[model samples]
Target: MGQNSSQGARMTSSVRVIVVGAGCRGEIYSQFASIHPERVQVVGVADPRKFARTKLQQKHKILDENIFEDWHNIVEREKFADAVLICTPDRLHKEPAVAFAKKGYHILLEKPMATTAEDCTAIVEACTQSGVILSVGHVLRYDPVTHKITELIDAGVVGDVMHIQHLEPVGFYHFAHSFVRGSWRNEAESSFALLAKSCHDIDLIHHWAGPRRCVKVSSFGSVSHFGKENKPTGAGNRCLDCSIEGDCPYSASKIYLNRVKQGHTGWPVSVICPSSLPDIESVTEALRTGPYGRCVYECDNDVCSNQGELSCDGHEVHVFDFLTQRSTKHKAHNDAPRNFGMSGHGGADYHLMAAFISAVANNDPSHIRSGPEETLLSHLLVFEAERSRLESRVVYCGDAGRR
Candidate 1:
């Protein structure tokens, strides 16, 4: 209900930020600080990975003294920046978020606040008690396509949204690289695949489904593919040694090495190799030894490949399986109409970054579309959906008395 535009735009100043993780999300969001140097500045950074830390430092020109391997080194010390951007892995979010929030650093915490509800509550409490601005990375709200669709629904252009069908289409190689062979491969290591990957979709759908609170929820899914039973008969544990790897679509060599050949050295490549610009030799060596080298079917992964019937507030939502065939990055057509159709997912990333900065700059929590309360609602849906999936029964999603 408050002003959405930058009416109080601070044209002459910038909000200082300290990036606590130099991974993809952290690095990309921090680029906003660089892009709008007049509105934001990167004063500090903390990331454990040498390559990621160095890449961000060189990009932002952060002083050597301001960069550290651990977030505690800065959060434990004096409050150095106006904001702390926490893009650490799923399991690592709570502590840095709580630490920074308590220190009066407004936070930009990544999605799925935490794996457990308790940790999420603790973080929300910390931010509320500290009187800090806490915004979640629900980038869909900032996405133009999403906004257009939301406007259409609200304006009655598409009539009523009685039922919503949303597909995440977590592409094949991407699934194998991240869910099967990468950091989010296991539930224990990171989180349920739903919370880790598709919380944005949940929040987006909920936003579009306004006024109608989710009264009931249910879900059904499993590790439908990419397990030991699905492994090729002649395949070994690692792709480098497997004689049948050339025929395997899920081969790490086929994915990462192909990226190497195509001059793709950033994300999926950097994740496997230890360097920013990885060489063929380093990638091959990594395939021979690292987690990325493991056969998708033979790894310790347990998250579901395709989730079905993820009903939120009694509305059925479909979450698709990861593809192993063609890979598609979140891209937009150059000539596409801006407000008429969909924009690629990548565009929303920076838009969310800008929205957060503007909110901080103007001291308006209303500027960021997804605040702590809305984020926690989506997280609750994630947990309830998972519970319903495992328990084989419909679950109510009301806040308190309805439950």
Candidate 2:
């Protein structure tokens, strides 16, 4: 945190950036430029939604000529910025990443790199060929806790690093919001639950494993909680019309409206309704019509809410768990006000951006922890783990790249 900020300010000129996909991730990364005006500046933005892109356009004072409704438009035109932040949806990553890398723009692509191993490889290859810094958005690597863990292992405090067990509690309401009714509900639409929600865990495991490559991988998971068979007998398709909605733990109204009552109109609330200061009526209307209101048990979501994967290098074992269950109560949002600023992902988002800016400003790739090759390796592990889950067999990581 300390060095990343000072390193960012060392540049002669702020690194001009183009933000593609002005959605939640897009907005989070774009805010970095606003905080450090001398380090980075948002010069262009591309998004299909007027409501989304307009926010960045106004906040960053981006010129009309630089605003684009499609990323293809940005690719066609001459590259205007030194770097591009590819925060597009999961399926849309490879094309934009490859194109932008070919265009010679240093890229900060969001996690999971791409849906397929081949696509991920292509992005890495493109960045390698173009000789531009390619930083995948593995924000967890920059977390203060993660750095401490790395230091302990490095300093021999944790002697002879062997097996590591990790758990990613995706949380009940959060799972319903993101993996059930939200953008990442289905694997085909986005990715499997492991890749979509818990890739961070996988990457972190890889980081701790260090040079000991995962030789054998096997995984298991299913949509046990949110399937149609689990829905209440008298439940309505939407929470608004449901008779037993209030008693349900995954109720949309209970989730979003309660947040509004707590004066939290950002995130899970803003995702459903576009209004800045959405009242109860607007949020209710959004739940009534939008996909967010759909009953968690009735949505088209097929990804597993509980997933487990085991990877080992023969001697040491690593266990991964992605558990999302019905909770009795949701945690209070103590940091809601600062949420609009840099406090996302335990403040790792800000650190990741700061490191990226430092790398771009100084033309030094070493500042990036999750660079192309390492990211591709971790993504391959995720893909292989999924294959092992579906196939019910062990998958050798060495065979992952060939496949």
What's the lDDT for all of these models?
Answer: 0.78, 0.83
1-403 in candidate 2: lDDT tens per residue?
Answer: 2344334545778899999989889999888887778889999999998888888899999999999999899989987899999999999999999999999999999987999999999999999999999999998777655665665566555466788888776678888899999989988889998888778889988988878888888888888889889889999999999999989999998999998889887778878876444779899999999999999888999898788443322122222222433322212112112443524766668778888989998898888989998989889989999999999888777754446
- Residue-wise C-alpha lDDT for candidate 1, range 1-403, written one tens digit per residue: 3333323356446889999888878877887665567888998899888888998899889999999999889977887789989999899999989989989999999887988888988899899999999999887676555655565567665466789887777778889898999989899989998888888888887888987778788888899998889888999989989999999988888899888888877677877775646878889889888899998988898888886323222112222324444432222212212232122243666667667888888787878788888788778888888888889888887655263
Pairing residues by index, what is the TM-score of model 2?
0.89
Clashing pairs in 1: 171-323, 172-323, 172-324, 214-313
Highest lDDT scorer: 2
Colliding residue pairs in candidate 2 = none
Q: What's the C-alpha lDDT at position 296 in model 2?
A: 89
Off by over 4 Å in 1: 1-8, 308-344, 399-403
